[model samples]
Target chain A: MAELSVRHLLGIKDLTREDIELIFETADHFKEVINRPIKKVPSLRDITVANIFFENSTRTRLSFELAEKRLSADVVNFSAGQSSVKKGETLLDTVNNILSMKVDMVVMRHSSVGAPHFLSRHIKANIVNAGDGTHEHPTQALLDSFSIRERLGQVEGKKVCIFGDILHSRVALSNIFALQKQGAEVMVCGPATLLPKYIGELGVKVETDVRKALQWCDVANVLRIQLERQGGDIAYFPSLREYSQEFGIDKALLDSLDKEIVVMHPGPINRGVELASDVADSEQAIILDQVQNGVAVRMAVLYLLAQKG
Target chain B: MQQQVILGKELLQVTLRRLCQEILENHGDFSNSVLIGLQPRGIYLAKRIQQILKEDLGKDIPLGELDITFHRDDFRRRGTPLRANATNVPFLVEGKKVVLVDDVLFTGRSVRAALDAMTAFGRPEKVELLALIDRCYTRELPIEADYVGKEINSMISQKVNVQWEGVDGGEEDKVWLVLSENG
Candidate 1:
């Protein structure tokens, strides 16, 4: 049996090249399993999984829960709103209490960076980070890389330019780790204000021009500006209009390129902001495929970890 | 490290022919029967048997592949994740008899997992097991193959290696009982 080196999937930074490959290979099998008439597999029937989402999310929460159910695992869902989290319990207290009920695995989404990593040290069960603050989103990066591989046949020797907010985007940081590990040259294309300090030390080129980045790469993973992550003191972008005009990915902007690059986004897509609706709905876009592939990617993660215990 | 050949190509061909004849006798036309290949290794034997049954009886029966990686009882006992084969059962098993095929029948745990996995498709009228090699007295579960090619004496420390032409990309079919690394 081929498996991950790490027990918990905390972030992409902790994953090696082979770990990512094993995940993609496993995801390839689960992708086929999900399309069959009986979409469920009786693999994790006895093992119970708990999905603890301290943050509000529509797609990630639903995707993790569905992946668990599809694997035939007994699932218990906990959100901050309905759970004892409203009663002012600590993260460890809420999770440890859930663990006391004999849960084998946890799928966690939190607003704090390193929350899953923090909980992993004190807990005994397996932990999968759905999305942890602006730190990293490992599964999203996996699916994005998987989608790019599906389009280009390989991730190595290909150019992947990530457009939009980088400082406040977990998707960007995780993808840079993932794509670079798979031998793809990565570039963060956005306003300099959104770009993090010493991002070049991560071995990625910082590009301010979106057109050249699109023209030079085979795929562009455009990220949203993160309206909530933005606040006073230091503005990431001067305004949404100026940012869209310069860094936004639209069909018209993409049409001017010599070749069409694959468009991708971690959704709750702001239609007219980071990417135009037409581009998101275009033939070149693989947003829906990414969503579809996310379930399989996560199923692979859970199924692999379930085998370890 | 030494191995002994139990059955070669000559006996393998004869065994498949006999299994086909036995199935032909049980269900004359195979009208309401579906053949399922237990995945990872069983699909080769299933495919060959399906081929022989088609050529002999002039029947095209439903053959599906079922992977029992998830249904295994010892998932947590291992340190690594199980590599899963594809489960490609296309037709329903609601009102049909399922003939489960595999390469070897050992402790019968895989067969048990296969039985559990069959429930997801639909309930079958009845299910039967067919294995090319059945190790006697190794029943961890109360399961037995209805049509077995050959019964061999073996120990838990030994492994049964079944090499099929279509499955293993070998020149011919053969079954060998070899000592495990620990043994």
Candidate 2:
């Protein structure tokens, strides 16, 4: 029998094809629960899921909350702005305090990379990394995989282009590993400065031109540019206009590619900077599908993780 | 009770090939058709069907999976439910002919629930059921497999399982028919 008991989804790199498939399968189950009149399952009836966000997040936090609630788990949201983190409590201590509340799972989003991994060691509760700094957002990657798998039928042997910010994107990093593992040829494209030098070492082809990457792939995942993470003289792109012309996915750039090619973005989208509003809102776009899949994927992650000791 | 056994591994492959041929012959154009397997055994069966169709007919079929535990009508009655397997359908199900594959068909509750679960994804052109073994009994629903391996009439207490190759790295296909009294 396939062991489905999985607790603590730390990163995409730790997941095997079986694990990925298990999540997809569980999400498929949740997909049914979601469409029900009550839209809730008693699987996690008395369990509690703590949403501890040390970093700011709207979509990720809400999605996790919805996922937990859908599984009938009691949810408690703790933001750094409202919690003991404001009173100089260390991250570990704050997490321990939350764990002391006897929550069954902790879905954490921190500004530091590997924060989830660190927390997993301290608490008995399952740890799910919502998004940590620029390290890895495992659920986002799985949802992207789910979205891609839904659109393409299978990720194996398909060409996937992940464009825009790679330097400070956990989503891009996670997708590179997840997609490649699922047998997709992953390509990363961005300004050389924004794209890491050793990214190609991850078995993904890194490109500097947007048009070329778009033409070569079946799916284009545009990443949001984190202006907050861009430091010093390296923010060389003069204006948003310049970035839009060079890196942004617009109508003309999309027109050159195959009509079957789908576009995606892990949202809170930067309207005109990394993606055009029209393209983001187009039929070829799966931005909303990404959000819908995010709930199902996170449910799968939580269900699997909670079952493991 | 006579042990209803599947003789060898080759028979399993042949069974799958026949099912694929039957599906192709009935469906004709596969452009609008998709196959979704219920998790675990069903997923494997779906993959096998996809392979047979690809090798025999040169048609690349869209294959996906569904985990039916959460959607089952008996979740509350069954205590803590088992963790669901991966559900991966990369294409839109709207207006496509969906063939639901499973290892064994018994009470038909699983297939009945699967049909209810599938409608949430999107409206499909039609959903045709396929199973390796159909233990003929009083089905909970009017659901019946469009394709079946061997139809066996069995008692409600009896267990009928269809085992395929590679289940435990064994190269033999074994069908186990066991009585509850033995346990």
Which predicted model would earn the best DockQ? 1
Query: Over the stretch A179-296, how does candidate 2's per-residue lDDT look in tens digits?
Result: 9889999999998878888988988998898888888899999998877765566674666678878898887778866665899999889998999888988999999999998998
Q: Ten consecutive residues with minimal summed lDDT in candidate 1 chain A?
A: A229-238
Off by over 4 Å in 1: A82-88, B57-61, B79-81, B166-169, B179-183
Clashing pairs in 1: A43-B70, A309-B76
Clashes of each: 2, 13
Q: After superposition, how far is residue B124 of candidate 1 from its true place, in Å?
A: 3.6
Chain B TM, per prediction:
0.95, 0.89
TM-score of 1: 0.93
Give me the displacement of residue A73 in model 1, in angstroms: 2.2
Q: Is the docking of candidate 1 incorrect, acceptable, medium or high quality?
A: medium
Q: What is the DockQ for all candidates, taken in turn?
A: 0.60, 0.12
Q: Assign candidate 2 its CAPRI class.
A: incorrect
Task: Give the top-scoring candidate (TM-score).
Answer: 1
Range of the 10 consecutive residues with the lowest summed lDDT in candidate 1 chain B: B76-85
